[model samples]
Target: MSNWLLPESLADILPAEARRIEELRRGLLDLYRTYGFELVAPPLVEYIESLLSGTGADLNLRTCKLIDQVSGRTLGVRADMTPQVSRIDAHLLNREGVTRLCYCGTVLHARPAGLLSDRELLQIGAEIFGHSGVEADIEVIELALASVKRAGVQHARVDLNHPGVLRSIIDSDPALADFADRIHELLGTKDVPGLTELGTQISGVQTGSIQALIQLASLYGTTGVITKARSVLPALPALHAALDDLDVLIAALPGHEFSIDLADMGSGYGYHSGVVFSIYAHGWHDALVRGGRYDGVGRAFGRSRPATGFSLDLRKLSSGLPAAPVAKAIRAPWGTDAALVDALCKLRAAGEIVVQMLPGQLQWLDEFTVDRELVPDGGTWKVRAIA
Candidate 1:
């Protein structure tokens, strides 16, 4: 068998891409700090039980698990950092009030989904625990939008939905369970015909409501769609309240664009209890960032802290981002003068990446095309050949 191999859905982050990702990561970390979110770095590996303590079945299934030889207990490579943060809040911090924690790291998932079809993912996000108010939700949403903008993603839309409405509808008819999942999928795809067909199989499915949701998904304009959705789903108080909260958030963020998906915009995580939202950009059909309130998830760890946060798929965002500006090579002066070495050291110390040539390799260095040249004079260096 061939020795060279890599697991499926996993790949290395090589030079240029890795450097660009690092720069983007540093920018996001600084932004998070400016927003008053304290940074935290949780261990990459954790006890399997603790790691999977509150994460739902879907996430548990996607977690990579193995026996920890040191402790003789099962350990899991974290699939998501949010759950780890929750554990930290519940166990480590042990403080009762709200806390804002930010993190940037690699989360390993066993299965790939949608745009995140990878075993290893670069995740950067924050979690606000111990707050349940719409204000907390608004803060998370605003931060999410701002972070996307900071990442240079234009034309990004934040789609908002409430799981309670769908839960209520699903509770009304137990038989609708089978069709419910399909309906949510169709809603995401904006498959009106598919939803209509699924609606036929379930009793009291409210074809009109389903149609309204489908129409809302199709609605692409500004805040006008919110008013139209309100007109369609008038009786759903939870939905209306959610829309009101959206309006408050929208009013606060005049510069950003948002849309409301009244139908059950299903979430990957079952833990999300209240208002759920996802951020999408022009090129990606799936969300680049997603999060929602998980009040119960906290309680599972005996904390009962209400929380709302989001994690950005950095890989997807990087893929959608414009290529980084290429680095220019610096040509060293021709002669073994002390000034040339001093200049090279200065450039290297100034954080400029440099390429050095060995003795007699200067001819090859000249043959190698470069973007810039460094000529040493009496005591200073001159920059030439910038092109």
Candidate 2:
């Protein structure tokens, strides 16, 4: 095997894609700023305890562990930045009012989530701490959609799932507890055969509930899906409340395409307590953006504040973008003339990309090779376009 072989699912990003990712990052961060969200950066690695403290056991499983030579304690490369952000809101900043925070960075997951996903993802996300109400949830969902819109994904569809409703179904009957995991797995993957078998395993009141839940796995298409669930599912308080939450969202976002997937079960990131949403664009097979509420994620730090947020991999999001624009740069050759140096600096300050050439070095930047060159004519610096 080649010594340079990268581990499975971990690879480098090339210049073209890297430029697109950075552009998306800046635009999304700017959009966050418009929503009054402040930017924050957390260290890539942290004490395992702090990093994995409150997110969930799933986060712990994905975290790559290491020994800190200086402290002689185990540290973990962050698999998710949510827990770290929670710590900041609850422990460090401890801001009194509702805090709006945004972050963009690379997170290392031990395994790739799917065939299309990467092990190392450039995560861009926003968090709202100190808000538990559904209004906060609405804001998060809106922001997620807005970010994708800003990324130029025109045909994105969002599927909203409420696990609490299913949680209620599972908790309502004690006998159904034995088959919960299998049921969740079947429901999430839409395994009708497995679900049919699971339905047979349950008896009495739980039997009817299991069958009703199983049928929902196939009930996804349009807004009517939500209405159908309200009409068909057994009337439970949790399900009723969750439907109302969905109602508010549907009303708030009129015209946008959204579907309700009640059977969307828990994942490795376990703390999501409310409506979890996934956005799928036309070309991408997987979700381009995802987030939900994790009310008590900060408990391990000190306070268990109400929190909700959304995150999208910059690479994945950019993959759905219409096209990557080429970089525009001006080539500056080596010269002793003070005017040439001053002109180069001025061009850079004015937001123009200026690439200065070194002595005896051939300028071979073919990509983004603009015809425009900085040349001096009649003792004056000017940008002249070559034929």
Candidate 3:
């Protein structure tokens, strides 16, 4: 194997893609700032307990662990930044009122999420802590939609679900407690037959509960599924509450297309509590954004604040879009003359891309197009269009 070869499911992001990703990150952080969201950054690695705080077992499997030489404790490379942000909101800031925070950083996933996914991800997102109202959910959802739109994604589709819906159903029957994981796995794929088989095989499992699970699996489509869910599922308040959350979100978010899948447990990380959502668009095989309310996340950090947010891999987002155009640049001959040096500095200060050619060096720029040239116009350097 060549030394230059990266591990499977990982690759270097070249100049064009890196530029696009960086621009998107800056634009998104600025957009979040406009919404009054302050930026926060957590460490890339921390104690395993701190990194995985409040997040479920799924993130545990995704995290890459190493023994810290300084403390001799297990440190985990973050697979997701949400929990760390929650810790900051819960422990460090300790603000009583609503606090909005945004962040951008790289995350290392132990395994690729899919065949097309890379193990390393540039995750960027925003979170609102201490607000449990559907209003906060609304704010997060709106911002997420705005993010993709700003990235030039066309015809973005939104999907809404509440994990509490399925969670409530599973909790209603004690007999189904031990089989929760398997149940979620089946429902994730909408494997109705597998669910039925589990129902028949498991001793003391209620027939009605299994039947309801099957019905929920099929309860996917337009927003109408929310209404359909109320009639078909059990009359548990928690279940209805989850359905109500979805109904409110549909009413709150207008002008964007939405689909509902009552069965999707959402990243299967188990922290999602209310009104979960995902954004999908053409050219991306998976969701471009995933976010929801996980009010309990802060509890593991000593405070239980109502938190809602969303994140997406900037690399993935950039890869799905059309190629970014080569940046137009002004090329200048390298020289130590004060006037020439001054001209280069002034152009760069004005946000112009200036490329200085070395002596006898070939003009080569894969990421930039030299459309203009700096020349000695009589005495002072001036920029002119290249013929």
Candidate 4:
């Protein structure tokens, strides 16, 4: 006999954690409903082409690929469900007006994205398609914040960004091309020394633009960050427009603590083309929620629609919750008594969990916190709290 060993970053979720995950899943979906977002479930796997059509393009290396047995085409285990949801919004639903959709499911990755991570993560998110405006961005951002609150997570901050700002600067300058990747990396870390060294290497690249770009790395915190950026960042028309969009977002999010991070450059997947945002809890290094405007993610579906969405790992949020309310059961002994059967059915129908204890299953009753027992009370069965 061979011993079974699970792959790295793959493990079974015990009952307690599973329960919490399920609870948060329901909590998040319920929250989306209040905003009129309809829930949709895409498949766990799909044709490689359609699966990687939109944001999935950024997830090419992350997805697990296999040949489809029936169609002889390639299939991919979804690395991200946002692309699939976009497909639904474009082809299946085909609504001309704005379409808001939410989904919860497990997405499989070829390998763990981080040192301590899972290959399969439960992803929950909401996306709005067809509206290309800062209003959609605000709605997604607000929903992201509301999701954290609903998950019982406290003291978290959402850092906002417009990757287009930095991207615009890179694309506009030919000298910045070779050093683009390194500069973007350095900027994200606020590495002044690295930027200085690199800037010194690129001769005659306009000291003003280089200095302004370096300044962006340090520009974060409050609405003042946007004001500061407008003054420091290069006066490119694209940069100015992106800053204006930032101002709108800041004004809309008054009283909500958020910081600007122009150097973020969107998610690791790089699908975000407009406003990008990530939420980080007080103690956690990783963002609990990440999403943004990928306005044309549905382009591959033959119909381009503006899209913005946010997704988080339910398993991660589950652990952050204080506790899950476990269900208590009423233990009913095995019997043919009409009174007992009717009592059990009625109790179950009324939403009270009644567990019928089989001959040898009495021990299992204790496992579910069986706090009550059904017993005969003057010829009528009644429930009494176990003492």
Better of 2 and 3 by lDDT: 3
RMSD of each: 4.2, 2.1, 1.2, 2.3
The superposed Cα distance between candidate 4 and the true structure at residue 203, in angstroms, equals 7.1
Positional deviation of 207 in candidate 4, in angstroms? 3.2
Q: Pick the winner on TM-score between candidates 2 and 3.
A: 3
**1-387, model 2: which lDDT tens digit per residue?**
999998988887777777788888999999999999999999999999999886656678789999999999999999888888999999999988699999999899988877777899999999999988898888988999999998888967888887777777777888777776677778878888887777676675456776777767886777687788878887888888977888888798877889777777448224788878888888888888788888888889989899989998998877766666677777767887889889988998999887778988776653365657788888878887767
The 0-to-1 C-alpha lDDT of every candidate, in the order given, reads 0.75, 0.83, 0.91, 0.84
What is candidate 4's lDDT per residue for 166-278, written digit by digit as tens? 87787788788777667767877888888888888896676776887778778877767888888778888998888889889878987777877776664442567788889
lDDT: which candidate is best?
3
- Top-TM-score candidate index: 3
Q: Estimate each model's TM-score.
A: 0.82, 0.93, 0.97, 0.92
| Candidate 3 worst ten-residue window by lDDT | 264-273
- Residue runs of model 1 more than 4 Å from their true location after superposition: 171-239, 333-341, 360-369, 376-387
Q: Name the runs in model 2 displaced over 4 angstroms.
A: 199-205, 266-270
**Residue 57 of model 3, lDDT score:** 86
lDDT of 1: 0.75
